[model samples]
Target: MKKTIVTVLYLASLIASAQPTGLPAAVHPAEQLAALDGGFWLAREQHQLRQLDGQGQEIGRLAIKSTQLDARGHIAAVVDYGSQQVQLLDARPGQLQRLATLPATHFSVEALCLYRDPQALLHAFLIGEEGQGEQWLLSASPARKVRNLSLPPGVVHCQVDDASRQLLLVEEDFGVWAYPADAERPFQRQAILLKQPYGKLKGGASQVVALPGGVAVLDQAGMALHLVRYVGQSWQYLRSVPQAQERDGIASLAQGILAQGVLAQGVLVRDAHTAQWQLSRWPTKAPTKPDTLPIVLPLAQTDPVAKLGDAADDPAIWINPSNRADSRVLGTNKKQGLLVYDLQGKEQQLLAVGRLNNVDIRQQVKLGTQTLDLAVATHRDDLALVVFNIDSDGVVSELGRIPTGQQDIYGVCLYQPKGGGLEAFVNDKDGRFLHYRLTMQDGKLQGQLLREFRTGSQPEGCVAHDAEGVLFFGEEDKGVWTTSARADAPSQARLILPVGRRLQADVEGMALYHGPRHTYLLVSSQGNDSYVVLDAQAPYRYRGAFRVGINLDRGIDAASETDGLDVTSANLGTGWQEGMLVVQDGHKRLPDGPQNFKYVPWSGIAEALKLD
Candidate 1:
């Protein structure tokens, strides 16, 4: 029995050596291969990656299932199937250090490729199978951040050709699909090369070899390979290459040589230079126009301030009752002080009030026997409420300073009750709030602390609806909370909008737009760069949210990262006949200048939102 077994093994070895293209006698065979600069990587049996030199000499080995090289061949990414992670390795000579490991979710990684964008940033594209014919494309950075791209189901294989800047994927029943490998833009479907029922291909595509202008597909169609080109936005069959034996894997090598890996026979080399390979540029798709929403025209913008960063934070508007055209907007420049702008957005007055954060206006406050238009703001430098009395000529003069008695003062709003007298609600960075009542004593305004409350977290952007006796404030990381405006009212606060429901964290500002019978509460969802409006009445149901998109008519940019906003129901003149909304744009990217306030017409908002 031992002699018979030895004779069988000897015959098997002899038959393997007599094959047309035979590999070197080794214990394990290569399942996958990737050619690099001076060497190549081989995925051998037992989940090992063997690095070989040009002379076919083994240099180093690692436990990886799949391997790919970056466009510059400076980095190599290997897939660890058992660990469910992709390992990035430095591909320099004698320095095969693992740089980073990115976690993957799919159960099995079928294929792996490396993509380098025009900026020379390296990315790893991994095709993972999650069972039940489900597949996912994961684009991962070296920092382990992954973005999953949705793909058609039943993807068999994927490859990237840096020379042609194309990403090719083979589906089970659907043929080959092409995508642009540019990392700067989002992945878009380029075209479908071939389908099962229409072409001469009988079975699913098992492998794909990327050529100069197109790709060569190897399927089970009479055991032959076919070349297809993308021309005129469609796939056109070029030619076919007859194969003597079935090739399991094919790779484009240097010097115009094609390496084909056969099952029993080793690697076969063929001169592809003689083939009439069509070399054509991939058709560039026309840029699709961005979906334009209703334009919110910016009537004017505040003059760019000198402060580079953290200059503009909040804004408040006070309309001149006698002259609607003389309305004034007061904006806080955190680094400078307060700036007063007219209806035309021209800076008419500048007060060096020292580091004020937020400002609000209260009209017709009867102080003793005198009526006053007051603008109160949070004085960050002194932790006090800085009051300003707006004269009939639209000029503002300092009234008095009242210490908030808090370490940090953030948002401030004035409430003038129907019963007369004015109250200021001031909040600190730690969510603590103090309500102060303003009165005249000896012909001078004085602020007396009436009540104090806490919102359990950081809060800012408070507004008062005096008619309804309701005060709304945003709890920075939480949501909008409403409470009583009267000092004698209950301390219990009700949440109008909770965190994470249409509203994101750090809810920055709150404004009220009072219509004829309906009122709406607009909150700045700073985290998502959106504005959410809700019914101001009880059960404050959510209306819709709209982003201040680009306005090409006025050549003004969109509003984002808004801190404070103010909307008025009273009509101003000219373009603002239906009133106006003023918002502090944190990022003033248009024309590339400093941050400033953007004036949006209230009519546009009402018509766009269909708000009565």
Candidate 2:
């Protein structure tokens, strides 16, 4: 009889019918729960957000004053919290909808999350609250734009991990902070703190999860559970788990902790042979190991091309002052325009020349009677600057365009002024800046604007030293400024790297290097993918910060959000004969396709910062 109707349909699918008995009990006290995919979401405390099922049965409610979850928990945003609005929904299984709402802001949102980046894009951070009380972090994007981000005045709650694409936060009496939820850099009011390990610690952290190399939290009036981890760029303290009550949400399951308490909820399970002997006793202290940073291995990579999202961003080495292994790097492909590599990273040329964004190189220019070696670039389609000459067998030709009547052209640099000619600084998208200069009349090369400055907000990675007439730029939200490359001088500028120290707020791509006695600079600490270096002279001091990691015998993959970089003391022969840096990886992760450029080996950053 067909196995007796398959044993009565496998006992009615193990007695399915989750529990939905017409639900009603949470009009105001859940505080947070989550679960999803056919059941549970809660959030209560009277602001409402329900959505039950699987026998608890409300099935979708949402008056919401708060709720979050997206880092693939499948959507859910909510939040009205005094009308700083936002909706988002779509939590799956039978599919709920609402997808996008956002709009309200003059501050008042009170904590939110969502993140998606790795080129997936979806953003949305929102913590708001300022009417003079301060507390920011806004960030939107789904094209609604937004930005803000200042935070650190008592945060209260925020969480995003998506497996260490991190965003954490917490703060009532000051503790946890983290951030870098990969919105591709520029939100850094300095956070990575963590603190509050004991010193009269009693309550406050109410939930935080993240795990797999640490995070856990959960305190809520001392029903404890800690575990921090990160060490090496800070975060430490690893042990706590005492909890016999009060949890109000914790998660992290595959077979172990679920928490959720209004009086003790369950799921602790994890004994399968002593859970790796209880994580090998968990407790170690002499851990002060910090200066290590040296991975570098990408000997040859550059023919993959299929652009779309972040089509690589900036790189410019060009050495070959007559074959240093025939060197030549260029790179910019900001959605099609310049590429050229070789010194093994192959690809020799692309040049569609339309988008182009930030690129530089000067090397021996003279022009009218000929000497050439230019390169320029910053053409965001037509705000112009382009140029390019090279040749002598390394190729690259165009040699023209110079517009810059500025509309959005951004970040470029090429100086050459130690006493004779050539300039070009260019910046836009609102941090103003112009400079120009370059000459060669009857033979072509033009540019003349001379001077105009600004830098109040959105600047872009610039560079120039030309034997110290100085220039360095990058104000994208504030940090790294230095000025006066002589255009009548006096534009004054200053503020070295100051958006929460060691550069963060999009203060990207600067590069100087020089060295023989330390010239350094480097910057591009694009909000923590790391590079900072300094001491290019003066009080520029702070000399340390690396990150480019991961090699696996040349399989490579660990440079994140970096945007434009190029260094070279010029040796360029074997594994970068004491020189080469290149970068622009913005998440290239090995054979993982699209976006490229990453070739470190400045002697592995001079033996990982023992510098010289």
- The 0-to-1 C-alpha lDDT of every candidate, in the order given, reads 0.66, 0.62
The local lDDT score (0 to 100) that residue 37 gets in candidate 2 is: 37
Model 2 sits at a Cα RMSD from the real structure of: 20.5
TM-score of each: 0.56, 0.33
How does candidate 2 fare on TM-score?
0.33
Q: Model 1 over residues 332-371: C-alpha lDDT tens digits?
A: 8999888999978889988987898999998888988889
> Which regions in candidate 2 have their CA more than 4 angstroms from the true location?
1-32, 35-233, 238-359, 362-368, 371-373, 376-415, 418-462, 465-508, 511-523, 527-560, 563-585, 588-592, 596-612
State each candidate's clash count.
0, 6
lDDT of 2 by residue, 98-153 (tens): 66676666666556666544433355677753311121212223334423456666
Q: What is the lDDT of candidate 1?
A: 0.66
Error of 1 at 541 (Å): 1.8
